[model samples]
Target: MHNINYVLISLLGGLIVPLQLAMINAFRHTSGATQIQSTFFLYVGGAIASLVIALFVDGSIKPPLYQHASWWMWLSGLLGSFYILCIFLAAPHIGATNTLLWVFLGQMIFATMIDSSGFLGMQIKKLDSLKLIGLGFIFIGGLIMIYSEYRHSSS
Candidate 1:
């Protein structure tokens, strides 16, 4: 329950995002496979590994509250599929740095909206000017990245 532990775990999770995308992009490129096909195996491998871990840790395949889960709870698979497909399609052309920069920026903007509105069962967290200014900084950074990429390509 300590804040330090939570932050460490969050840092680890954050560190994995770009690495995961890079691995996915590399796999797609080397295997000469379609995004859907590559993404399918990624899901399958994740499911298998998760199942193994769950069985060892919890000693059961089913969650305690599976019966009470809402239909929307199952949509993460669809969302993840689309996310992977987008990264796979975009990373090769734009480079992973630019792709992840824009992705993180979008996440910040939309997450601010989601948090402020308390959408989808999340707790309401009001956004302030500081948060808006932070978002502006992120947008400006992405614009600079895009302009740089454009100039490099045009040259």
Candidate 2:
């Protein structure tokens, strides 16, 4: 049951993504900010909020032991920036629903591979038939979303 609470919390995080994209899109339109500028501000705001939260939680914003960390761990910030920029570019053009559907599909596919392979020192979880079926369903849903968007745009 504790794990279920965590799952619900994660789901809440997922629910926020589209809203965040929409807000960012609105901010770009209203502020006349370029994609890069909006993304930069987004990260800046996130950094501030994260620092505040860290201080509140731990009583000090202490740095991690970076000396022991692998080089690839550093790629997270770059990848996150790229992802936000992509979302900023995509959400307005594709519609948030379509953009998120494709994004979620892609995430699930890659996450499954990561889980199965234990990439980045993550615990290995064997990919099973159920997981494949779940992926299949998500892929089918993405196709449906694409078709629906095409029909809506064509009409």
Candidate 3:
């Protein structure tokens, strides 16, 4: 399944998110575009780019099997829309590092639950002490980032 390729691509996507968010925020400043307007254009651009890539990579486009899909599948984009909105609002106020620290912490906790419980068709994995320790470290690091930011702002 080209697991290594998937991992590399996923890591690259993760690394790009902060940079993209920062750039989009800059556009909000320079272009006088509101966050919602910027986000709308961002998704418009993404849709066009994705279509271009799919035309090459997919070879042939086919309709998705919507009959077999759950009702929630249609609503999934709402989550992304909310996340993008929050990223635009929070990153500017909190700074990217602090904003992403909390976001990553939330993602890690929910992802651990999803992985361990086999939620949404994922393979079940035991959540062991090592996993707990890793998550704990992440939580502590996020707290530290928040505290440091608060202290600096207060002074």
Question: Per-prediction TM-score, please?
Answer: 0.88, 0.95, 0.90
Q: Which stretches of candidate 3 lie over 4 Å from their true place?
A: 1-5
What ranking of all candidate models by lDDT puts the best one first?
2, 3, 1
Name the TM-score of candidate 2.
0.95
lDDT of 3: 0.89
User: lDDT by residue for model 2 over 1-155, one digit each (tens)?
Assistant: 66998999999999889889988988999999999999999999999999999889989977789999989889998999999998788888888988888888889999999999999788999999999999999999888988987998899
Candidate 2 CA-lDDT value: 0.91
Each candidate's lDDT (Cα)?
0.88, 0.91, 0.89
lDDT of 2 at 37: 98
Question: How much lDDT does candidate 1 score?
Answer: 0.88
What local lDDT does model 2 show for residue 116?
Answer: 98
Model 3: per-residue Cα lDDT over 1-155, one tens digit each = 65999999989989999998988998889999999898988888888888889999998678899999999988877788788898898988888998888888889899999999999889998999999999999989988888887898899
Cα displacement (angstroms), candidate 1, residue 145, comes to 1.3
